[model samples]
Target: MARSVRWVTGAKTQWTIHGEQLVDENRHIRLSTADVELPDGTRFTQYVARMPRCAMTLVFNDQQQVLLMYRHRFIIDQWVWELPGGYVDGVEDIAAAAAREVEEETGWRPRSMEHLATFQPAIGSVDQPQQVYLARGADRTDTAPDVNEAEKLDWFTLPEAATMIERGEIVGAATVVAVYRALTLAP
Candidate 1:
């Protein structure tokens, strides 16, 4: 069976605002008009952002557990268990950012890592696309954490993590998604 594809219409930048110090908002498709002619002549206009993000799932083999951080989110006003990750700096590769974040948050380094998945939590409003990576054979060398970002660090087994998810102990969107994926991919 042949599948049909849609084409984009002409679009223009309407306005932009600073979402954060590093990220910005762009209302580019607001002025879109003149539908583009596709091979099948079907057209569509979609608002999108080109934002970038980085995330990691840290798995420690010796303890047979995953490294998680219990951090207080100011926006939510609660501490939640989550995997360590953050936004990638300018021109920083995703793998480097993942390793840096894991070390920054948990004071541990992974011996190896591999790309897992990419997701966009909110396509309608937020333009951030989170890059998820899996870190294997991690080793703990220190207890220091990025004090400004997280509070306590802990390790959880797969079953314990499932329980935490069910009990709502793990709340961050990216963390939850990544953890779930890791559990499924676990050997």
Candidate 2:
């Protein structure tokens, strides 16, 4: 048996989709144009992008520091600090993906991972769901991080991480959410 939760419904504001035409597709994303009708009877075609789900983690150590990756995003052409994460492979469990990303990208195996939150980075035009996890601690392995993953891996105190966010040095949406979540949980 499943429990049902009621939502505030606004039928008049609901938009209807007539059809979606595929623009292009790849293993990473599917692009399409949707024929949509708005509540006021206005119709239009809108570009939509469907991407694979992603998983990220905030891995904390005993010293109250969180592991982070300093890397360059060619798309944005900026070097930033981010939580370890990657796209979840087909049919792979999200939690497992988060753990694998942490170890593969930072050489740190999280002791345990608890789901912190799930969100859409771009709700208007992109369907990319991101899951954020929290790990209290991790152990460093002899394995080195993937060469292309990051320029460096380091730990920052929660305050330092917050400062980075304020400075716009930590810009990924998932990283920002996880850092703020971890800050509230920190003692």
Candidate 3:
């Protein structure tokens, strides 16, 4: 049996700059608007922002506990528990980025890492795709927290993680999704 796939076309009609921000007083992002046409004879406009892809990791220590970060997101105005991760640098490989992120955020280095999965949190609007990796047999090292990103770091058992999710403590989409997947596939 064969399944048919539908393809849609969009044409850019107009683009305008809305605003810009200096992320670090040097790097900046310019938000813009664009009018597009749909293949189904529909016309619409969308606001888009250029961003970079990010890499994250689900790291398990010798005790089988997963590393989690307690961080505050200004945009969301709340603190949540999340996996350690960050944007991919142009000069860095994906696996390297993942390992770097884990080390920087959690102070743990994995003896072995395996690719787990990749997902777009919001494909319709956001351009960022998050790649997740599974790191096993991690050893705790000295940690230097990136104060701008995370406030606390800790390890949680699977049951504790589930409770956090149920109680709305761990709310990041990628963190929650990755944790559940890792728990299911854990040996």
Candidate 4:
């Protein structure tokens, strides 16, 4: 049985933290385990990921094709497609981070940027908020993908990208979400 604890938010007492402990942590991710009780006194344990927020971009060229990166994610032991993005540095602006990622990963700098959406990719366990930006025009930069970053960069039409997702070739969460948003938000 779960016990009640004073919660201090919105005068709503739906959640109570019974106990929590840090399981592991590093520069990139912090994992914690928490025992929580719900309004109905239901208790459960959850492992949470405390990671820095990420910034990603959905950039389209003059042909209305989206840019993407191909990289081999060791975790899945397979190659996957992803967007130009990374964690927001501690002292850098989020939008600036997005632009920096685009330049570093794809050698392109946005002429104008617009916010498409901010989303929590895995709210159930991770609180990593991703800011997706829609970039209208970009110019080539001298920079290139950092060593061990992207294997290659390419562009695909909106429908082709969606088809890639349907084929399980585009498996990145940020890529999938940003592509969906671009298709709906722009088209």
- lDDT by residue (1-187, candidate 4, tens digit) is 9999976777766588888899999989999999999988899998989899999998988888888889999988888887899999998998889988899888889887888889998898998999999898789988866767888888999899999999988998889999988888635
Q: Which ten residues in a row have the lowest lDDT in candidate 4?
A: 6-15
* Per-model TM-score on C-alpha atoms: 0.71, 0.92, 0.80, 0.89
Give the per-residue lDDT of model 2 (tens digit) for 77-136: 999999999999999999999999999999999999999999998999999999999998
TM-score of 4: 0.89
Task: Give per-residue CA lDDT, model 1, range 1-187, as digits (tens).
Answer: 9999965569543333222232344332122222233444455543344555756665556767888888888898877888888878877888889888888877888778898778888775556778778877787767677888678888888789878988988887777787778778847
> How much does candidate 1 score in TM-score?
0.71
Judged by whole-model lDDT over C-alpha atoms, candidate 3 comes out at 0.79
Off by over 4 Å in 1: 1-51
Q: How much is the lDDT of residue 110 in candidate 4?
A: 84
RMSD of 3: 6.0
Query: Which of the two candidates, 1 or 4, achieves a greater lDDT against the reference?
Result: 4
lDDT of each: 0.73, 0.94, 0.79, 0.88
Backbone clash total for model 4 is 0
All candidates in order of lDDT, best leading: 2, 4, 3, 1
Candidate with better TM-score, 1 vs 3:
3
Ten-residue stretch with the least lDDT total in model 1: 27-36
RMSD each, Å: 8.0, 6.5, 6.0, 5.4
- Count of clashes, each model: 0, 0, 0, 0
